[model samples]
Target: MIIPAPPAPSTPWPLPRIKLHIEDLDHEGAAIFQGAVNARDALHLAVQASYRWLYTVDNPPPKVTQILLILRSMPGVAHTIGTGRDGMEKEIHFSLEYIVHSKARATAEIMGVLVHETVHCYQHNGKNTCPGGLIEGIADYVRLREGYGPPHWKRRGEGAQWDAGYETTGYFLAWIEDTYGAGTVSKLNHCMKNKSYHKRHFKDLTKCSVKKLWNAYCCLLKDDDGAKVLEILSARDDDD
Candidate 1:
């Protein structure tokens, strides 16, 4: 029998007003972006992904009043900045150059980047004391959960540290959610809302310290048979 789809989020979190700014309408990236996705829908979907993965209906979202998407010539993929008097306004600066470079995979890459950057607009950062890597990882976790992970991402057995960031920590976070239960990552995110960053939060949520959790994850990866490894690596761009 076919299972019914999960119900859409019942409580609509207050969404910020979305705006877009293109530095050069004549740029090829502008044409590509416009062709790839509807600006309003893409931004709205990205915000929803952030809320869906990082929070629950019972939890009120952060007070972000506005988000401005800025596409321009930049050195990196993209980055977000919070402005306004209370820093409740967010601006996502996307790199036109990067978009042009990824022309073959433009649409998917654009959506993934939007989802990742949008997470930063809403995620808790332990009063800005959280590790930067963890922050980035959490963002990528939202992107991955939203079904926007890139073709190059891989689940591996090792990294320099648990908070190595991006897909490394993102997959680790996914593992934590899978092993513990749904909403484990959301709980982890909520735990840091009012407090500073601490490794103890992991123990509080998973009954294991972060270090121990990472070790267990590594051990699991190492012990997996070839088939299991393939299963782990099966989540790719095509899956999106």
Candidate 2:
């Protein structure tokens, strides 16, 4: 809670113990990463990004006491793991392979991945029962909200289900925040804090059921006259 940080104004999020491990120092990606970003600043910024997007200054942040960042020649970009037992100690495994491939946008890409994974470390999981896509979506949503979304990311057409995850649901949720009002996603995150995830939760907050929202979103995408469609969609007040 309260980010477990001191009142001293050094960093935004309570400065956690940042441990960095380079498994393959000889790897090219490791060198690129070292050159592109400062380890301490990147980690601290990622935590701040999570807090700025997800929590208010008055709200209690997650009790993440420490984070261990492991840079290795892994297959994927990165993934964050919390202490299997305690849930406070988080470990981030960043792939040197992904880094090497993203040389052009190394700084932003790395920061984006770091921001995304950091959200996973801080956000609640509804007792490990939250849908995986929704979980991933929220992470990307925070990253996007932080202005770290990649250049290629876009507000995807609502083809797949809303929970299809990644930037798809992330953009949709962003739209929800913009269209309805600010703090819509924040409220959604707070709803998941102590209770299980459910469709009715969406209904209770937005007045429209999740299915109805998704259907309306998809319909808006299908209409050729985008402005008119958006107007119709916006007219359905979501205040609750």
Candidate 3:
């Protein structure tokens, strides 16, 4: 049954109308999901996480009138889709099966997935031309920033290309923020809002070519003895 969700906690960022639907309320996964987190608050936090990391007051998120969260028995974790042609209404489908499998760490896992999927709700995709890996990397970046990163994942940002996505790209972006200054990633995101994806975007912001940036970032990883990576970057193998 579809239930109209509660109001979001007051915030300055734009918030979409939220909705919830559980395929079978009696399912054990459904019960675990409920016990793990309050549906309303978690959803709100998901939206806010996207804005918190990707946007600022002057350059806000794109308009999203509503977001419908649907929980059901599914194979994968979760994914968000824009149901409206104008991109105003979004639907995030979360898997009940996936939820049940992570029952032991349901709270963090649920929130992580919610935050990851929710980023898809508001992130601009460079007019759908952004690299698939970069899109997923940006989503996981928000997940990582919120401290919802899974324990199984390595903290190191090594052995992968910069756009290898997920934590690899996420940690790289984090390093850019820490090294360059705050809002570096935010500026990168805003540049994508109106133009097609291009490597020059990195240069425009950092005054360095993407190749030099990736190489410099990777060089820092070698000095860490494989212990810390969140502050480092990944190598880029353009040949591959």
Candidate 1 deviant stretches above 4 angstroms:
1-7, 225-240
RMSD of 1: 6.9
Leading candidate by lDDT: 1
Candidate 3 lDDT, tens digit per residue, 46-122?
Answer: 89888777888777888889999999988988888888778789999999999999999999999999999999988
- What's the lDDT for residue 189 in model 3? 86
Top candidate on TM-score is: 1
Q: Find the 10 residues in a row with the least total lDDT in model 3.
A: 1-10
Model 3 global lDDT (CA atoms, 0 to 1)? 0.80
Reference-based lDDT, residue 155, model 1: 78
Q: Candidate 1's residue-wise lDDT over 176-221, tens digit each? A: 9878888898888898899998888887886667876776678677
Compared with the true structure, the alpha-carbon lDDT of candidate 1 equals: 0.84
lDDT of 2: 0.80
User: In model 1, how many backbone clashes occur?
Assistant: 0
